[model samples]
Target: MKRVFWRAGLALVIALAFSSIIYGTSTLKNMQEQKKAIQQQIKKEYEELKAKKDEISLVYQEILKYDQQYFEVQQVLDVLETRLTEKKTEIETTQAQLVTAKEKEDVYYKNTKERIKVMYEYGNTEYIAVLLESSNAMDFYNRLEYLNKVVEYDKTMLRRLEDIREEIEETEGRLIIEKAEMEHTQAEALIRKNDIENIRVLKSQQIAAANKKKEFIESEIKERQREEALLDKKIEEHIAAIERERQKQNNNALKFKEGFLKWPLPGHYRITSPFEKREDPFTHKIAMHNGTDIGAPNGTPIYAAADGEVIYAAWMNGYGNTIMIDHGKNSSGQHVITLYAHCSSLVATKGAQVVGGQTVVAKVGSTGRSTGNHLHFGLKIGGAWVDPMKNTKK
Candidate 1:
């Protein structure tokens, strides 16, 4: 029809510059393998969080050495129950002094059996009838000095009742050897309180096996943080498909100026928030504030709001140190991308091409899901997102 539509417009401009160099070399090879899988998932959750904090601090120092030996076996069973109540009150005062020394040896055996029944009923004929009823030689020498002082006072009261029955059987054999040594120290303090309750039940079963191996290494560090959040959503879907194929090959060298785009933060910025339904300055909620922010400071810089090429720089996630670019299509066919997000670093590199207001690339930060040193920016076109204040540049 017209040289077959001019070779299908030169094969759609060489298939849009070979799909923008294969989506910018597969988005810088999946963001350098997602930064080496987030440094091997933070070195395996820091060695399983230091081996579960050193196995719960050695099972809490072996349950404090079995609770300090069960408080020294309850202080030796309270001193063997206070020496078994003073050995049962010294065996009841040695059995009340052996019943008062057998009641004073039965009152000296009833006065020595009534003086041996009056000398066996008149033994020496009552000692010659008391020397012929004494009334002569000075009353028979006073009846032989009163019968020899009544037989030496009944043999000194039977030798003091056999020495108080041998001192009450030697004080009841020393109070039965101190009540068998207080019942053998209360049976060795109840066998050392049952061997300290079996060593506190085997140290409480080794502190429940160290809290079940620290809950299985904290569920394998939450499954490696869900595989590093699916590798940050596969590096943000390959940097949004290489910024939509480098904005369809910079849709014919876009150069727009007055309101077509570009004021991506150069001098005195301000914006603070605009894109749309506000709020969410870091999940304050509401929602759709997709881009715009601004407020720069800590490091500031940033630029490239148009020309574009760098299909993405690096760490993205919530958009920390990002980049993106690709500015291209306009009139209606939409494509133009932009996005600068929380930066604070990355000085244009990914695919590098930049231009617009002289690509400074990135700086202003507060990193990902930020809240302070702003700059968010963001934009897009064919792949959706619209109000970057509808083409920026107020």
Candidate 2:
């Protein structure tokens, strides 16, 4: 009976051990799943933020292009004005010519009227009487020739006057048409001028809007930078905690993954500036670039790299709209912090535990001291700034 009791006790112990092992395996699996989910969430959020930023940037650029077009229209209007003035001068000259032609026509008509009246009153009777009253045949013949010559001369004068009148009328008609054309041209020029003024006003409004957008974006960027810095601090602390925990556990097989991380945005966005100590674009002086700048449109969505708590989600001075997340320690005891700067808004909040590939952040904008829309991602290690790309997983 004692021997039987011993065997039963040993079996119970084996059963307990098996149960413990199963429990530990399940817990580890759950943690890994959670971590993966967090990473995915971070990536998703990063993409969304980038998209928002890109959109805003595009709008600003469009506004600038419109301004250029507005100036061009103004130039065209100026040319139109000059053309109208020249056309007015031409019209005036045409009017004068028309008047002169009318005067000449009036004179010709008057002379023709006088000749016709004289010829009508005298009729053919005068010619016949002059011929009969001749002293001899030779004289009569000579007198007839002189009478015919006078009638022929009068006919010639009448024909010349008629031709002059017709020519004058034609010229006046042509001048009238030219004057009408000039008036139309003048009207068109006036319309063009009005259009140009309208365009200028519209462009001015656009410029103002762009400036306002830029201001907002800049403010947001500064804020993001601060948030990122804060997040970095938190992440470092978390990493250190993880390291301590790992050391206590003494797990020698676990290792942290390492490589340059891919940019959160999908498009092949350009890096206007790199992570390093460099000169400022506007200041043109030596300054430290706390983060790498990735150019994109405004209102683009931002994402997190791994699972962690959001330490900040607010406006930072130079980072514009920003988001900072802290990823907990890996098996190897390393902590990770990711910062997103120059955002239009913050979708996530402080103390919120976010998952990876989630839309926890927004796009980078020209919020503070920025020339355009772009993301400034910063990483930190042990309360010190580190290259983000270097720590990112491949």
Candidate 3:
């Protein structure tokens, strides 16, 4: 009975040790899988942000064009106003001519009427009587000639008055049309002037807003640089400590691997700028791009790509609003570290164990050496910089 009990106890101890090994392996695998997922998410978010940044930039350019157009429209309005004034003066002159013509026409008509009436009355009486009562043929002939001349002169005057009246009516009709055209032109000019003014105001406001945004981006970059510096210092110390602990525990067999991790953000983000040996966008000089630029908008959410412990969650130099996570160990015993820079804000705290696909960072404005709002993602393997794109598959 004593032998049997001892054997049972030994078997139980062996079973427990095997179980522990299996559980530990499973936990490590889960963490690796989580990290890969987070990396992919980060990449997606970066792509989305980049596209949006481009769109916003285009809008800014369009606003500038609109300003120029507004100025041109204002000039056109001025020309229209001058033309309208000239039309009004011309209309006034035409109206005066019409009034003068009408007055002359009325006077001519009154004189013609009186002359015709006298001729008609005298023709039956005194004119004819004088002709008939003449003492000689010469006297009668003279009176008849005088009467004929008078009648001819009166008929000419009446025809002249009729012509003048027609002319006055035609002139008045033309003046009325001219006046209507002037009023219409004036009204159209007023509308255009008002539209130009409104457009100018709107364009001015847009320019001001763009200027303000530029200023804010500059300030943010400076602050992010300072924070990144501090965070880098902390990260270095933390990695060193972790290395020491791993060696002491003889767990150096497991380590982080480069080119095997995934993105940390969601969405497809284009790398407007990349991490490489290239010319700087602002400086126009050859400089090392320390991190990859993934353009995004302000307030876009950021996620973790893998399961890892937050080693440093703070700002660093040249990296605005940064976060650093330490993925424990890979096959080579080297530590894996992921850095997120130029974030708007940090959601996870240092020492917190974050799961893959979890929101750990916030999208923010460009914080370092950046022209716009974007996130700079960096991957460091065993304290050495590595290309983040190499690890991304999709």
Candidate 4:
């Protein structure tokens, strides 16, 4: 009876142990599922944030185009302003000429009236009288010439004064028309300048709004990251266990063989900024630059740095549209990692295998902490930031 009781007790304990084990497993699975759901939510939110950023970039590009047009309009306005000044001076000169001609016309008419009265009083037959007094043919010819000269002189003076008056009137009329045209041009230029100024103000407001939106989105992203970090730690721990078991079975460590890799970018690639101490664009403080900034036009293709596994491919804080590759081991037995940042779009997925100088991983962009379109390439030795130029070829 005693032996049978002891065996029954042992069986009960075993049953409880098995049930406890099953319960623990079920609880852990539920926890992992909850974490996974949160992670998925983070991913959804990140996507929305990036979409807003892209919109902002497009808005900035539009502003740039408008600025170019504004500059051209301003140049035309300058010319119009100058021409208007010239027209004003011309009008002044024309008015002065008109006044002088009017004065001369008055004098000419008054003098002519008096001279005509005198000629009438002195008898208008002077030419006939002089011809009748000639003694011979030669004398008659000389007296006739003198009379013709006096008559022609009076007629020529009147004709010259009349011509001068008509010319001044025509010049004044032309000047008035030109002045009106210049005033119209000046008005049009002012209108256009005002329009451009209004556009600039509007664009400035939009740009500020965009920056605010970015800041808000970035804050939210950071909060989400903080929450996700806890989950990530647990997930990494689980993955590390699996990796350790696999490495034990192989009797070897996970390592990559190192070699001189091909240059990731193609076709006359230039480093806009080098990996050195420089002033931070945002803070204006001196800081160390960890990577070389390769300048490129927006949408320029980006290739993988070497043959490696894509360890991370996503948008990260301060490193937008980032890709991180694990390229085996270096001479110091440290894991060689290369990072690419500020891409417009990504083609490679996480955990994807890629070949050096071949895979088109992303396109260059001005995504995060950047002033223009470019790629930020980084190197990490033993998980610490290192200069990529040491390993770069030309």
Candidate 5:
């Protein structure tokens, strides 16, 4: 009876244990499903957010394009204005010359007319009397020669004055035509400026709309900051690795002339951001900008800052498409490196040699953590990041 009672109790315990195991398994499965659903929802929200940000990004690109165009047009307008000033001066000078020529012609004409009038008043009798009063054949011959010389001189003077007037008139005509052409060109440039202004106004409206969603943009900027941090680490590691290789190779020979670095993006010298500590664009916190941000149109060619070997040309986390060149060493025996980031596309491949101010290393872009199209240029020396503008000055 005791053995049977013990077996019954053992069976009851087994049943309870089995029931608990099944319930635990079921609960675990349900929890996993819930977690997966949450993950899916989060992913979906992220995608939606990305889509909205991309739409705004496109608008920003358009604004950038128009801004670039406006700059170019303004440059053209400046040149035209300068040329017009010069043209006006030239026209004034030509007019002065014309007036002088006219004055000379009028003086000669008045003198000749006075001479003719005096001779007419006196009549042919005077000439007849002088010739008749000659003493001999030699005297008459001398008198005739003198008369012929006087007539020739008068004719020559009149003809020369006519030629002078004609030449001056031709010059005036040519200048007038050139001035008109310049005016026409100036008008066209002004028209272009007006058009650009109108477009700018439209862009301003778009920007205002974008401002309405500032919260979203601020969030995106935070995301970019995180990515930028990661990219900064990657860049430092890359530079270190390249430097190590260079040191091992003992390739410390200077590869370029000692001077200020070439401005990487030609015709785009406007520094959108500097390499100094400033309040972060969106975060409102003090942050150090590691590089100089040069505003440029998308796809603008980015040249190598100095003669160097392309040690790295690949996609980085937040820098997007990047190109790094190792410029051997500076006069101080410090290894110099230049980095160009946020490229639309890279032209120079890894390990390729490049010439400063000549090689098209990459194209400008708004890739990675960028808010607009620009060239983010960084300078590294002796394994430390320094202000590029300061280094260039050195």
Candidate 6:
């Protein structure tokens, strides 16, 4: 009996240990699955954020295209309006001339009618009587000559009347054609006006929709800040290395033109945001803006700040399409570098030489963390980022 009880207890212990081991294995498997799911969720969120950014960029680009089209239409409308005004003036002048012509025609017609009536009343009897009463052959011949002159004058009056009638008909035909052309021009102008209005409405609607998605942008603020800092550090390191190498090579320093750096954007002087500490657009936190933001229409040409070699021309972490030009050392021996960011397209390639105020380096755009179309320009001198406005000239 004792042996039987001991065996039963051992069997119970074995069964309990097996159950515990199975439970532990199941819990471990569940934990691993949960971690994998969390990673996937994070990845999915990041992808969604990228997609939203791309969508905003495309929207801005579309709006820019519409803006250009609107400008072109406005020009056409102005020309049409001018033509219409000129045409109205021409028509008015023609109408006055027609009135004058008709008056002259009426007067001549009345005079010719009177002459015909008198001639008809006298008929050939007066002419024959005058010829018979002539004192000699010379006088009779003179009376016959006078009769012929009178008949010729009557024929001239008839011909003049026919010419006036033809003039009236021609004037009337020209008036009709002018009126038709004016109407056609009016129709064309109306179509252009309508097109401009439609584009304006679409652009306004798109802007409104974009504004409503501010929350989405706000979510990316923190991540973008971190990425920007990292990118800046990377740039600083690279520039420093370049300067060191340049210094090592005697007379190898890059050359730049004299005077202040050329303004990157022409016809775009409005500063959307200055290089000062201000509330961040995305985070609403006080942050230092390392660069100046110049508001401009998208696709506006961006020129090089100074003559320099293109060092970096590619997409950056938060700056989107970016360009960096090394303008060598200044008169003070401080290494000068210029940065242009958030470009829609890049014109200068890396390692290419560019001229200040002459080379078109890129096109203005709303890329990366931008809220609208503009340029974020940065100037680094002696390893420190400074306000670009201080060294730029329009």
Most lDDT-accurate candidate: 5
| Each prediction's TM-score versus the true structure | 0.35, 0.38, 0.41, 0.52, 0.44, 0.42
Global lDDT scores for all candidate models: 0.70, 0.62, 0.63, 0.73, 0.75, 0.73
- Model 1 per-residue lDDT tens digits across residues 170-246: 87787678768767876886787678678767766766775677677667667766777776777777677777655
Largest TM-score belongs to which candidate? 4
Which model, 1 or 2, shows the larger lDDT?
1
TM-score of 5: 0.44
For every model in order, what is the number of clashing pairs? Answer: 0, 66, 50, 2, 0, 0
Query: Candidate order by TM-score, highest to lowest?
Result: 4, 5, 6, 3, 2, 1
lDDT of 3 by residue, 1-394 (tens): 2223223423432343234345545555554555455455545545554554565576667766765665676666677577667766765776676677667767877877776688687767767786898889998898899888887876787677677667767766776776677667667756765775676577567657655665565455555554555555655655555555445334322433445456665684778778687776666777666567787777777777556666666655556566776666566655556777777778888657676566555565677545787777776555566677886544
Worst 10 residues of 3 by lDDT: 1-10
Evaluated against the true structure, the overall lDDT of model 3 is 0.63
Tens-digit lDDT track of model 2 for 1-394: 2224223433432343234335555555555555555555555555655665665566557656656765665676566577657656765766676576667667766776776687689876766888999999999999989977876876776576567656656755765676577567657756765765576566567656656665665566556555555655655665566555445323311222345344566563577888787877776878677677877777777676655566667676555666776554445455545678777777888657665555545665777567788887777544455777666643
TM-score: model 3 vs. ground truth: 0.41
Off by over 4 Å in 2: 1-143, 241-394
Which stretch of 10 consecutive residues in model 5 shows the poorest summed lDDT? Answer: 1-10
Local accuracy of candidate 6 as per-residue lDDT tens digits, 67-141: 787778678767867876776777687777778777777887788788778769978677789899899999999
lDDT (tens digit, per residue) of candidate 5 on 10-44: 34323432343355455545545555554565566
Q: Which residue pairs come into collision in candidate 6? A: none
Model 3 CA lDDT for position 210: 55
Misplaced by over 4 Å in model 5 are 1-38, 129-135, 204-214, 217-394
Q: Which candidate, 4 or 6, would have the higher TM-score against the true structure?
A: 4
* Candidate 3: RMSD to truth: 27.7
Badly placed stretches (over 4 Å) of model 3 are: 1-76, 120-126, 129-150, 206-214, 235-394
